[model samples]
Target: MTTPADRGRRGKDARKRVPRSSHAVWVPPVDRPDAVAVLERQGRDRLTELLPIRYGRMSASPFAFLRGAAAVMAADLASQPHTGLTVQLCGDAHLLNFGLYASPERALLFDLNDFDETFPGPFEWDVKRLAASVVVAARENGHSPAKARRAAQETVAAYRATMRRLARLGELAVWYQRIDAERLLPLVRSDADRRRAEATLTRARRRTSLQALGRLTEVVDGRRRIIHDPPLVEPAGASDAAALRKIFSDYRSTLSEERRLLLDRYRFVDAARKVVGVGSVGLRCFLVLLTGRDADDPLFLQIKEARTSVLEEHLPHGPYVHPGHRVVAGQRLLQAAGDIFLGWMSGPQGRAYYWRQLRDMKGSADVAGMNPGALWSYARLCGTALARAHARSGDRIAIAAYLGSADTFERAVTEYALAYADQTTTDHATLTAAIAAGVVPASPDV
Candidate 1:
């Protein structure tokens, strides 16, 4: 067994291969793949009709482009030198990806919520993506470049500090670490910010399945039926519904025995094909409504298609071969507490899909409208949450030692973030140009 001292030495030794100071550099390779081409490749296997919506959403802003261009960023990061410290990355850890969600115990916790592109890779990749997002968001919000750099710096500092703190704790203590939503109020300085935070939490609590039932379903012919919103949300056809029912049991088998018993109590009522997220717009996604006890008690489960991680081609293969299983396993390992219904199963045509509650008190911050102070605070919180997640799956002791007490890594990452934000801006423009030139179809109204 490696001792703590040995672990510390290992982290320190990594600096020789990739010095912490080297992280600040960001010069895109001359032969970097065209951003639109990368996005088009991702759309090939997706629902072709929905591809327009994806391009339209991503073309809205530079940050939106970054959100949808994980493939582009993944390739860029792979070309750079890294610390070689591996962790199960939240592969697309942009600002909006960190959010508030309920634990199995019903407590509200804030953590990394998206895992579609999650895979094992150098830990710094997640950090760089997150920092770059902060800069891009800050710029879009009209903050000065200096302010953007500061926000990104605070983010990395919080991550480094949190990692070091977690390294000093016992294994179980580190595993149990989490940021509770109630604690967020005290972290805010002004009453206005505190009230806003409280309101956000309250709003999230109201986003339960029962709320969704009222908002997304209506009584027709004495039965609760999912409301159709056209291309965004439409009822599944007879054949699609039949396929869902067939695979329901296989998905249930992936759950724990107790959870399976609990799931058995609910009767499947309806299914719908729903478009979701910027990057996931074209992917096959479905919403399953189940009723427990009575019609008023509703449970909405989302079955989303899972593709190989954007980082998969850049790094070594991970343990799980099945894409759905990979997403489910990564979520379980990285989350402080996971959903009871988290599961995976092969769909028709051997497509991979993962299942989870559609909404259980989940909410994300509106980064676009946030002031500089608010953005910095939120960015730091995201950084802390990310460190806690990484500590659970990677060598915290080594990472902490590598980061040290100095702010060198933070400063370097801030510099890289600003540079990468420029790249994202350029990439966003490229996509917009493609849409303008009729090279890509986009539906901005959607």
Candidate 2:
């Protein structure tokens, strides 16, 4: 049997792509359920369909380009080197995707922030996406192409070193020891970096379930309710509310006996329709407020609508598991420590999506204005983290063997990222043209 380590030792050929079996599961097109079609459609409906994909509409000119370029980039990325080592990918693990959050013990934790489009697929796919993100971010920040290339090269280089280092570590050591905020201090480079790091730690320390409950829960005329704001969210309708009461019964079956028993103490006070995320905009998401003893003690849960992974069609299907279940589990596997309330369940509409605390001290790194060195450093961290994630799931030894020396993979990916960055530019132009022609509604904010 070729263990991952043994494969790593064999040198490169073993890691080469083997013939793959056909996809096992059938995922619907992005156009499924009518809502996603707008995004899938281009030209006539291109800009309009592009709205949900863009977050914070006016945050930056480049973000609009990024959103518009997804379909374009996905088509391009579908054409890269694939390491059949499938695990839940962050789908978009850019520098911005990493953030500070609280562990169950309330310690500050920094890890991957986004997971939509997460599914089993090629490991290189993630590195490619992240590298492109850096490029896009660089372009937005007015960095020259040479600077962007430097950032990408450094990131890929770091990824190679990190994977090689982890490959040598005791398996248990690699698995158990995480770079938590508390322990990650040794990695900081400067006083300025340390200030931001310490600030994140301070914020993470203040986060708790109590904070999630405080921000999301409220009492409405003596009935506990999860607050709602229009377009963004609204209270669940009477009919759906009734259905959730029944579904809650079934949902209980999915939890552990103890968790079900613990939940039994709380009454499902109120539920509301909520909208969330950029790529996931318009997908069904909801907030459910559960109270224990009285309205004062509360738990806030966002029951997001999960859909088939965007990667499912592009790559072979992974092990059989509920999409929502796959997300929560994959996330746990990738992150050192995930949100304590990180759990999965099906909802009233029968639509699938994962849910978790909305805030929990969530804050990501600032990518714009970063010097070439900082960008390189940041890329290294992202690549290293991504490598660790892959190693945890599949045979890293085989991967290391295949990767051989970091030089080839790094060079190949840099070339690929550079070419793809050009493609992204074209797609952005396509979107901009569409917006001008009324093909899509381009918001100015993001």
Highest-scoring model, lDDT: 1
Instruction: Write candidate 1's Cα lDDT for 271-307 as tens digits.
Output: 9999999999998999999999999889999999999
lDDT of 2 at 158: 75
Measured over all alpha carbons after superposition, the RMSD of each candidate to the real structure, in angstroms, is 0.7, 5.7
Would you give me the overall lDDT of model 1? Answer: 0.94
Candidate 1 weakest lDDT stretch, 10 residues: 183-192
Task: For candidate 2, report its TM-score.
Answer: 0.83
Every candidate's lDDT: 0.94, 0.63
Writing each residue's lDDT as its tens digit, candidate 2 over 1-446 gives: 76655565544543434321111111233533321233444223212333533523422355545543344445445644455655457666656777677766766666777666577766767777777777777767777889988778777777777777777777887787455666445556777776765675776666644676677666678765666766566788998788667766655665667767877898877888765555555566667777788756667766765556656667777774677877777787888777656667676546555667666766656667565655666677777778877778756666665565637777667766666666556555554566667655555532
In candidate 1, residue 396 scores what lDDT?
96
* Ten-residue stretch with the least lDDT total in model 2: 19-28
Candidates in order, TM-scores: namely 0.99, 0.83
Task: Report the C-alpha displacement of residue 57, candidate 2, in angstroms.
Answer: 3.6
